[model samples]
Target: SFVASGTFSRVFLVHPETAKTRRWKEKSHDAQRYAAKVMRENDSYIQYTSDARKEGDILKRLEASQIAQGKEVLTMRCFDSFAVVDEVGEPYWCLVLEWLG
Candidate 1:
């Protein structure tokens, strides 16, 4: 179900137990929950999609930096990302992130 929305994306809750596919559970391993940030699919959302993709990139860099420094995670981490065609045939960008809550 939809959980939240930001300027560039909408967030959806991903419960491992209820997920239709086992891919998420298998890929995330011990992770039990996730928040997926899906980019808006409208025609004028090009800028929004770019910004959302940048956010995902920055999150990945942050996680890498923390890992390199041997510091405990103090922030949400992204687990996966991909583009999927929506019901309307629009390709929407998606970033799967840790559900800190």
Candidate 2:
């Protein structure tokens, strides 16, 4: 539900939550958004174990270090994730990422 299928990893647009009048006055806020990369299991390259592992390592590195900067004032953050299950109950890994707008 987070992303729509696309040629590359699916891109998602996120909105900032609005705060109550009192809370909004207490802190300064900026707009934030992220894109979740869900590797499509149907893709032929997904069948390669090495490809998955490599991609996972790359993502892990990004998560470990807040080292990647995106456009404008955006930054990439590795958030929570879940496995996509098929009818047969096979689980496919999916990454929940913060997309820099």
Best by TM-score: 1
Which 10 successive residues of model 2 have the least lDDT summed?
67-76
Residue 75, model 1, lDDT: 69
Q: Please, what is the TM-score per model?
A: 0.70, 0.42
The digit string of per-residue lDDT tens for model 1 on 1-101 reads 89998666788988656446666555555558889889843324545335556667889899999989999877679877787778889778788999876
| Maximum-lDDT candidate | 1
Off by over 4 Å in 1: 17-31, 41-50
Worst 10 residues of 1 by lDDT: 40-49
TM-score of 1: 0.70
Tens digit of lDDT per residue, candidate 2, span 1-99?
A: 355765545655555566656844664456565565666544554543323334655666765555444424233455655667658976565666666
lDDT of 1: 0.76
- List the pairs of residues colliding in candidate 2: 34-99, 35-99
